[model samples]
Target: MEEQFYLVWPPVLLLLLSLGRRRRTLVLGLSTVVVAASAASWLSYRTPSGGSTPDVYFSPVLGVVPLATGCVLALLLDDERCRSFASGLAGHLGTWAGAAAVVGVQFWIGDDWTDHAWTFGLLMPATGLAAAVLIGGLVSVRTPVSVALSWSPVAWFGRRVSYSAYLWHPLVIALLGTFAIGWFGNVWLFAAAVIVSIGAAYAIEVPVEKLRARVREARRLVAEDHAARSAAAS
Candidate 1:
């Protein structure tokens, strides 16, 4: 739970992102190193019976591959031929397979989590890869998956407050814990948390945005007044 374990990724990701468009080679090369180092670390990691390596446990190593993978994808997607190939026959089925794999992989992890070396080692990257594919499929113009995800209400709420929902869900669950939510169930607790988080996100978002707009308007007015005075004095 020590948050410092999460700190290494952001700076590296930012460094990759900060390079100008011309720094493709440097960014790609460094990203590849990150992915490799992360995998190596994961593979070589030795956890005690009850102890945890926060870095691997938090899956920062697993995250590196995806960050690098995304960069590779952005490069590939930029090519028209790659785009055409992605929309081709195999592409369609691959996305669907990826989505199914995401669901199936969870069961796999639950099946014999502790004993499986490969599964435990590769879990983060494999799962992240499947998830990236599912997200890719959902946004793809050629797939019905896109249509399903784009349903008005789902998309609207997701766009509006998904971040808020993520931020507030755990807090809501902790708050509700004192009530002994077993009366209804954990599912009820989760649902309540989501609702609270979304509402909180929306409430904060709308007011903060309005305030920002007002501040921008006030600045514009001040600039206009200064310009007008300068013209008159001239």
Candidate 2:
């Protein structure tokens, strides 16, 4: 939960990258440095009390690593060398292996091993890159999983509720915990969170979005009217 504020780092980095989009080499070099610094910080830094590494975990550097990796991967999509690397049987095997390694690392580390730098630094970014590649590849190929995800209802629900769910679910879980609702298992908790979040999001966001759309339309119409008047006057 403390890490929520640090989530801003990804978008901030993305904005910087967007600003420097024309300078691809410079952006790549900076991204590489940031990633390396993040990993190095994990490897070198330790808490004074030798407990969990919350400082490193919640640091802005670590927060940007995954999204930064994704951005780098996106940039590489146009590269002939990268395309060749991702096209063949070897590439397919590498993608699956990377995915498996991600899962295996999580299983090996278990839920209690939060202080490990190797997990945060090396494994996390690797897994994030692997996931981006795997998912991108799947969607590009239009696999059955991607097709189901693209279904109108599913896509609409995701577009509408995903951000709201991400924000609200933690609060919902915290509230449920505070209420001493011990009967709810993980699945029940997840179900409750989704239902409640979706309803709340629809109630809140739908009206706001409609208002925004109306505002944009009004502005457009006013601008067009002014332009027409100027043209007629001229």
Candidate 3:
């Protein structure tokens, strides 16, 4: 079941590629139908072998409905005609509305969030919708609170180290537990994990990216030099 998670990429790639080849309207329609259908029938899906975990890869039905929502959002946002429209949409989402949205999501979750199966079940699509709106607001030409959020040093630093942080977070949590320190819920534990994750990002991610850029530059120079030599010889 763990291995099945990797299976998602191939289908997602195929779906995205298919959408890329289609007209904007067609892609929107297709994505809408997919997300709607997946959400509508999400409740009926059962886990394999009576396990607690729901099988994300539901064979004919894709696991990530919210992923479809993201695809639609991407399609809309990437189009030149959509640029103004997206900006307008973002400008309309004021600070008050953003606060209200957060409250609504929290209220929907309630106290016993984990125990509530539907909350967990519907979370992905809900999160996708919320993220789409927030992202749209941030990237919009005219903004209010989103502008502040974008400029905030905390957000800037998190964005820089986020990928490596993601990679290390689970391992950090596990190590803390093994060492009898603390679990994920502890603030101190999270702080330590974040520090370690940031260090990892600085040590690994930055270096790898720099090396990749240098390799690309080297390849380009080699190609140009070869062309020059050929031209000179001729």
lDDT of each: 0.66, 0.69, 0.63
- lDDT for model 2 comes to 0.69
Number of clashing residue pairs in every model? Answer: 0, 0, 0
lDDT of 2 by residue, 111-135 (tens): 4456566667776777777677675
Query: On lDDT, who's better, 1 or 3?
Result: 1
Q: List the residue pairs that clash in candidate 1.
A: none
lDDT assessment of candidate 1? 0.66
Please give the TM-score that candidate 3 achieves against the real structure.
Answer: 0.70
lDDT of 3 by residue, 1-234 (tens): 224535775586568668765546656675676566556546555534533344443433444455556666667777777667666754466333644675578667643443433543466456556766666556665555655666768686768777777778888877774554434456777787889988998888889989999999999999999999999999
RMSD of 2: 5.0
Root-mean-square deviation of candidate 1: 5.1
Which has the higher lDDT value, candidate number 1 or candidate number 2? 2
Candidate no. 1 TM-score: 0.67
How close to the true structure is residue 118 of candidate 3, measured as C-alpha lDDT? 55
Once fitted onto the true fold, the runs of candidate 2 whose alpha carbons sit more than 4 angstroms away are 1-27, 44-53, 78-109, 178-184
**Model 2 pairs in collision:** none
RMSD of candidates 1 onward, in order: 5.1, 5.0, 5.1
- Candidate 2's error at 197, in angstroms? 2.0
Ten contiguous residues with the weakest lDDT in model 2: 136-145
